[model samples]
Target: MAIQKEQIRTALAHVLHPEKKVDIIALNMIQDIIVQDKYVSFTLEMPIKNDPLTQELSQRCERAIHKFIDQDAIVDIQIGINVSQQRQTPAPEPMGSPLSGVQNIIAVASGKGGVGKSTVAVNIAAALARNGAKVGLMDADIYGPSIPTMFDLFERPNVTVQKKLIPLVKYGIKLVSMGFLVDVNQAMVWRGPMVTSAIKQFMNDVEWGELDFMILDMPPGTGDIQLTIVQSVPLSGAVIVSTPQNVALDDVRKGVSMFQKVNVPVLGIIENMAYFSPPDAPDKKYYIFGQEGASRLADELAVPVLGEIPLGQPIRESGDNGKPIVLDNESPAAASFLACSANMQQQLAIRAATMPKDLSISFTEKSPSAHT
Candidate 1:
């Protein structure tokens, strides 16, 4: 017989919590259990703050539940501690603007910097917009915002009637950059909290219209900024960009692992500066940056290699001139970006159908009025 929540609960009703010496299920430590087609995923509510048995309980639950179902059935388990009533009081929903418009939020990240991560971000956003999808690009690299330069916009964003700042738009792609807000000659030497607040403001205070995708050019490396963004934003997916070199590929693994750590599905990897194809002899290709490091990394990591962007003068020239190569729509670099965007869209659709749904936990579907 297939496993059911009732059966699992009944079985677990005998499993005692080491600290409380009470049945875990009966203690209400089990928050939600969901069984989908051939898949099982659930969240465990922990009562003790800083419970040391959280991981143990999660593993035991998974193992115990799988015994009733097929061994091959997939299980995703999340462990969370229940806070006190006073601590859990609902936060007031931001009144003026919520991130209600953007459909998909994608982070364009790199293991290390100088991998053309920002270039890939801008071109991909441009390509998606060109393909009839409304898009927004947020330069989350607080220390080094490049989206403003890529879009060729130097004007500071202005406040709207709603008091939210209107983001700059160019080539049909909306943009918000830390660079535009700060002096280039100065450095962003703020601490973690300061950077997080700025990123939050960029996300919540900007008037980004209904967008199909919001591409975040994340700061290189797995650090506090990365974790803050991952926790705060409901990211649809992530794309790692790297060049065809061992050093670059080494960092790519770290980048991918960070996303996997948080259960964020990686869309794919893009290999920038894959090769150089001379314009004169279009057929001849040169492996300027070694060979297929990204392809090798993807194969070993079991992720898709979205596309390989060649070393094109137009790509760099377009950046310096504030126009993405993808805007040209005729160059090979532009074609590669368009292909990557298409592939990413397809991957996102597949993920949406398979990923577990968010659990909305509360007393009632609607809250009671204060007067009541």
Candidate 2:
């Protein structure tokens, strides 16, 4: 006997939102249920995009569906933010007044944690620096500042005589991170306002002089911190990083949607840890997390897959040792990062060329007092 959509819905009815105390089907959160043979796919609407409950609910619903259907059946769940009731105003203009000297500002973000987002941010910045572009990497992951350990930078930034904070320099890349200001063991149990203020200071009070590119390593998820950073900067574009896993790819969609809602151009998606390749056997590839998951998601979202970074020991070792893999010219991971950076540069150029003159001018024009 074939499974029916109604039966799947009944199975999902057994699962309830912990807080809402209502089944997802009863709350009208499930939509477009498509059942084909042993396959089932549907969209799960999230009331809060970054709420941790979303993941939990997704897992519960998946388990419920499998209870009535074949255990080995492929169940696909897409998460969509329910913002139909929200106002449809255009995103604010780039906050370029305080950062007039920066030629471009790129944000590296992930929909979920543990996706190697910071690693990608650091390497991309390092690759851009190696290419002779003056680069700055701002570790905006205030709660979990790994940039300090990643770059082996432990000293606090020096305050200039003019009261501006001087960004620490390493590998020709100027860097700022919350890790530098706070103790390594301290937790940043801060609220939204505090996070917003800290990011503002990183931009306005830091002496990031003459940077061609400022790469922001945004914290995971679509939350207040992410919202503040994007709203307060004149971003050139955003690049999303995700491992090739269904769970990660689901969050990637939310991340993409967040950027699109804010009117920020999504440059591309980079599939980090796309596959594993052993050093001894260079020709063999291992899809430990599921092959091309991110690429498939990118295709569905109509974005380009900038690059596929393989999982390797050297990449992890380099980060732990405070050296980015992109600095190691001979490593395959380094080559991948460099190629991704080059693709990003090309995308920026294309965006500039295609954008209207007025819009382009807004991002590039320096304020008269900015030089003084």
Candidate 3:
């Protein structure tokens, strides 16, 4: 028999929401259900905005449908917030939020940690800023907020008028991170809800003025944290970062699949540490992790390969010094980042020109349930 909507719903009902401690179907969370010939789609309405459990809920739904149907079947799930009618009072606006300043908030993410994802995010923002585009960097990796370190901002963030927090400025880029306010040693113990709350506060309370790009330095892996951040902001698209090694490539597929299931348009893939070139031997390139794993992955997924960043000491030193290699016009690493920025701009232009217009989740405060 072909897969039925009731069959998928029944299976989902068996998988309880881990945090809510209730079956997803019973909680009135599954708002709509539809099944095509070989495609299954549903929307899981969350009770709270940026709910950490929603990410887990998405995976369970995917698993249940895949188990009963074909493993290759297409599953589309969107996480939305259910409107609460009981509350009489309205919620106040959020501060230091990325959606406030940028039209398109793109998260640079990875499947597994330690793939130099933050470095790519920071440099990408720097390259974009240097090109006369206003940019902001939000260090959304709550437990491991590295944007402050990347920008070399040791000073604490201050509150602005309207009682919102102002982002730190460096090399013409505005930035915010938990590293500036919390004790670095204590953040690791934060629970799921605490992390989600912090991300909300960052987005709602921060004063990010006008920006062309607000790059979120997302946490690694397809975990609760990643999902929470995705649900918290209105993202223009997602850029997956990965190395060319086999293990990293395997996890990259999972990361890509997560975005696909959620219907987030993947901008492209950025292969960091693509190769290593000695400072002295600029002409020589060594393939430290093999060749073009990310490019091949892009081919398989039918997304563009944005660019590959070669591994080099200057790239590391520049990041450590709070200066992006892109600022050093003569360096090859700097040139590569500039090229990548141009490629990204071209891709955006192409999308705007060729793609049909549709209503995506809005970043405006009016649509609180929209995905960032």
TM-score of each: 0.72, 0.70, 0.70
Which 10 residues in a row give candidate 3 its minimum summed lDDT? 84-93
1 or 2, greater by lDDT: 2
Query: Which is superior by lDDT, 2 or 3?
Result: 2
Residues 232-342 of candidate 3 have per-residue lDDT tens digits of 666667788888998999888888887765556677888889998887788888999999788888899888888888988888888788887888889988887787778
List model 1 lDDT by residue over 343-371, tens digit each. Answer: 98888876664433332232211111110
The numbered model that scores best in lDDT is 2
CA lDDT, every model vs. true structure: 0.77, 0.80, 0.76
Clashing pairs in 1: none
TM-score of 3: 0.70
Instruction: Score candidate 2 by TM-score against the native.
Output: 0.70
Query: After superposing candidate 1, which stretches have Cα over 4 Å from the reference?
Result: 1-96, 358-372
lDDT of 2 by residue, 7-99 (tens): 888888888867756667766677788899888877776655554776777788778876766787777777766643221122232565446
Looking at model 1, which ten-residue stretch has the lowest summed lDDT?
A: 363-372
- Output the lDDT of residue 286, model 3: 94
